[model samples]
Target chain A: MSNDIQDLKQPLAKANAGLDSVHVFAPATVANVVCGFDVLGFAVNEPGDEVVMRRTNKPGISISKITGDNGRLPMDPAKNTVSVSVEHYLKSVGRLDVGVDIELHKKMPIGSGLGSSSASTVAGLYAIKTLLGDDSNPAKLLPFAMKGEELACGHGHADNVAPALFGGFVLIRSYEPLDVVRLPHPKDLWCAIVFPDVDVPTREARQIIRNKINMKDAVTQWGNIAGLVSGLFMQDIDLIGRSMQDVLVEPVRSMLIPDFYEMRKMAMDLGAVSFGISGSGPSVFAFTRDEQTARLITGKLKQHLNSIKIGANTYVSTINDAGPRVIG
Target chain B: MSNDIQDLKQPLAKANAGLDSVHVFAPATVANVVCGFDVLGFAVNEPGDEVVMRRTNKPGISISKITGDNGRLPMDPAKNTVSVSVEHYLKSVGRLDVGVDIELHKKMPIGSGLGSSSASTVAGLYAIKTLLGDDSNPAKLLPFAMKGEELACGHGHADNVAPALFGGFVLIRSYEPLDVVRLPHPKDLWCAIVFPDVDVPTREARQIIRNKINMKDAVTQWGNIAGLVSGLFMQDIDLIGRSMQDVLVEPVRSMLIPDFYEMRKMAMDLGAVSFGISGSGPSVFAFTRDEQTARLITGKLKQHLNSIKIGANTYVSTINDAGPRVIG
Candidate 1:
């Protein structure tokens, strides 16, 4: 892997000889994607983070500025997910001497279960890649971003970072060697995401799950996972909706979110194909066949939250097929 | 669903007006297919069952002859899987008055984890469909075959029967409405199945498993299942091999099969991509990248069994893409 990275350095340096800085954006990702807890995710527009990088002669990476996070995120370059990822990338390419300065713009809420940390990590890594003139394939940077996720959450997971990096629908096919597969995206697919005004720490949400599960439930979950994959490939909306039932994680974790069941029922009644917690809790997502239905579901969800005396934010958008891109 | 079947009767009768008899063959199936415990299966050639059906004026199904079972199987039509399936088919089409004489040739060993009962059920249903001129989709026959499996094994399941009826690799996407999906099959894929001279009742094998599974194990199993499906679609042999790891059922069920570990190690050493118990136990199967490696593994397995003083039957064949069909 290091050798492969080295091969890209010369070409990348030549390509970016005249360039000194670059800016990139990484979209917010919905992890778990209903029936596929810990293994499936997809990207959505809005609620993303942006990062800007500039070449420096200081011989090390530094965080120059941070905004929109209200000081909730760390400013230490070594402790932050973005800078940690950049440090790893630099080490991997044997280019630690290449100094860089990074600016993080966190546009999403912290601890909202909207993959806030993953967005920063992906955007940071992407921005550094652009500044270094490393025309390396985007996927090669996944490991570095995964390392950053590990720094933030204490365990490495790619479900969020993968979609934020590759876009569309992504499956973490295996965890041992970290195999990720990008699945086909269905046209006209829309997502309705609602973030309630609540803070559910990722670690605490993960701890709520028990160590054992019913074998019957496991069989049902796996069947649905395979069915979900098949549905995506066949482009069958009804099948996709049916395959989105969660039998493993949702039943336990949804208890952390208020009115989770009632909200999901309302979404389904309003024509959403499927509804579930975005990742752990607080943030809920629904899939619909068209943008009109998506908007309707979002409107109803917002109304429901308002009637319940809860502050919430909702967004309706199609799947972000173009993961992260340079901002002009 | 019954109405849908009834609608096919008139057209089926017209199509079968001149036909008096029909014979069909259904290939043996490997259920569970490692990673997918009760929802995945595939067909293989050589070890299969044949059913012959003759239109009769008697008004009900009858089992006229049974071969290769040593009288272990029931002779009564109501008790036999094949006749049970035929009876169900006739009832579905509102053609119970159309009597048929049936013959069962069990070419594969019963209780060998080779889907012996499912093969008989599928072949019988296919034969009846042909005699009645029912050109209805083959998938429509799955429910009838699943009923036959319930009669034979005291539980209803479509994992084996689906692939036996549809051919190639199959996934039972959902159990509520019984959705089955045919997966892409790699042309170079080969399966090596070895059946030891031992009996393992499906019910007994199932009883050995606990009701609950470790949540971590379930996660790993589902991840591998997703990986397996991706591998098949991508036609990646190494990925398929890596994804064939089964952490849920095999550890518990392998205890019923003698020398399971030794045999699996030998097969892997001989270049088999993956190896595991075929369905319940006693019969073991290995996957290989090509026919040559499949043959080599089979030969080594046979020799190992002989050396251990255990009689065994081994088969080397590619996936049976053409499911049940008529043969002269």
Candidate 2:
């Protein structure tokens, strides 16, 4: 893999000579989509992370500053997801001799169950690639981003990172060969997301899942997965909504979120096309056809969360087609 | 369901006033297409069954003739799958008193694991509908056809019957609501099918499957399912072939088919896109992009089976798009 990246750098390096600094904004993502647990995800527009990179004459990598994480995130270059992935990217391109300084900015909450770490890592990687003038396919940078995910979370799952890096909806068809598939969706599709301020550790949530499940449920889940993919291709909103039903994960994980079922009922009544917990939850999402409906759902959900004496944040945006963009 | 069918009969009754008899042909189908397990299926061009329906003065459905089944199929209206399903259809349409004489010709081998019974049942249903001038959607008759599948295999699965009735590829996304979704495929897709003359009972094949499976395997299977659906939607033949892997059923069921692995290796070596057991066992299939590759595969597979002292029938044709066509 490193050899492949080095080979690509030879042709593009001359084109990237004059760049000294770069800044990027990588959007937050929702993983474990309904009926698509661990296999599907999509990107949203708000609550992301930003990273600024500067080339230096020094020999290695370092973190110049950190902000927006409430001092909870690591500042060490070896430990932080942002600097760690950048180091790997530099190594792959045979640029370890070239020093780079990274400034980490966590625009989203840590452990919000909305791929906070993934955003930071993808932003850092995107910034480094831009600074080095490597304009290869963005998907080529997925492995470096996944290395950061493995550090943030124990598993190196790609559902969150793939969408955050490539934009749009993606299906990680297989992990062995790292087969990621970008799916088609309606242009008018919008998302209403609510992140309730609650403590639900990713490790605990994962342990609660059953190691084995009935074959009958597996068939139902795969059937729904097939339906969901079909719905995306056909651009049928109604089919996508109906096929979002998830038999596994939600039943056990919903208990961790206060009034998850009640929120789903309210969202459905308010014309949300589909409702499900985003990532591992405390953060939940609903898909809608129009921007008005999306805003309405987020507003109502935010109010409900406040009434329950829980702090929350809400966002309404269409699916993000451009993943990370240069903001500087 | 009965009320729904009866309500649809009022306006189309006059259009069928003069028809006295109808002959229809329903194509054979391959269910459990690789990773699809019980939800995916497609129709083939050849090796189908023919049914001839005649309006008579009698008060109920009666089987007048049975041929090509080698005296194995039942003649009783209540016992035969063709007449039992036809009886159910007539009753559902509030025409239980209508008289119909049916003649079933089993053009394909019985117990070939290639949906022999589904073709006969779908053909009979189509013939009855055409003879009575009920010009409704062919999918409306799926439930009655499923009844025939129940009698034949003891499970009312629509994988075979749906494709035979609706044509092309289909996904039975849900069973409770009986949701069936038609999918798109590459026009050049061709299938090479082989039915080795061996007895692998459907009951035994089903019984061998573990009721409980590891969650990891389930995840892998669903990922492949999503990939396969995406491949079909995108018309990516390579993706479709890559995603047609069956980790759940093929591992255990392949033990039943003699030299299954060897055959798969040979087929792959011959440039067949994908290879797997079709439906259950005793019958296997390979997909290719062109007719020459398909014919070559079937010819080589037939020769291999003959060398092993196993009688086999081979077919090479593109996907059957016009299912259950009227012959007379």
Q: Which candidate is the best by lDDT?
A: 2
lDDT of 1: 0.87
The local distance difference test score of each candidate is 0.87, 0.90
Each candidate's DockQ: 0.73, 0.94
Write one digit per residue (lDDT tens) for candidate 2, span B149-235. 999999999999999998899999999888899999999999999888888998899999999998899999999999999999999
Which run of 10 residues does model 1 chain A get worst, by summed lDDT? Answer: A10-19
Please give the distance, in angstroms, between residue A161's alpha carbon in candidate 1 and its true position after superposition: 1.2
- Relative to the true structure, candidate 1 reaches a TM of 0.96
Residue-pair clashes per prediction, in order, are 0, 0
- Candidate 1 lDDT, tens digit per residue, B20-88? 888889999999888989989999986899998888887988888999888899999878889988898
Q: Name the runs in model 1 displaced over 4 angstroms.
A: A1-18, B13-18
Give the winner by TM-score. Answer: 2
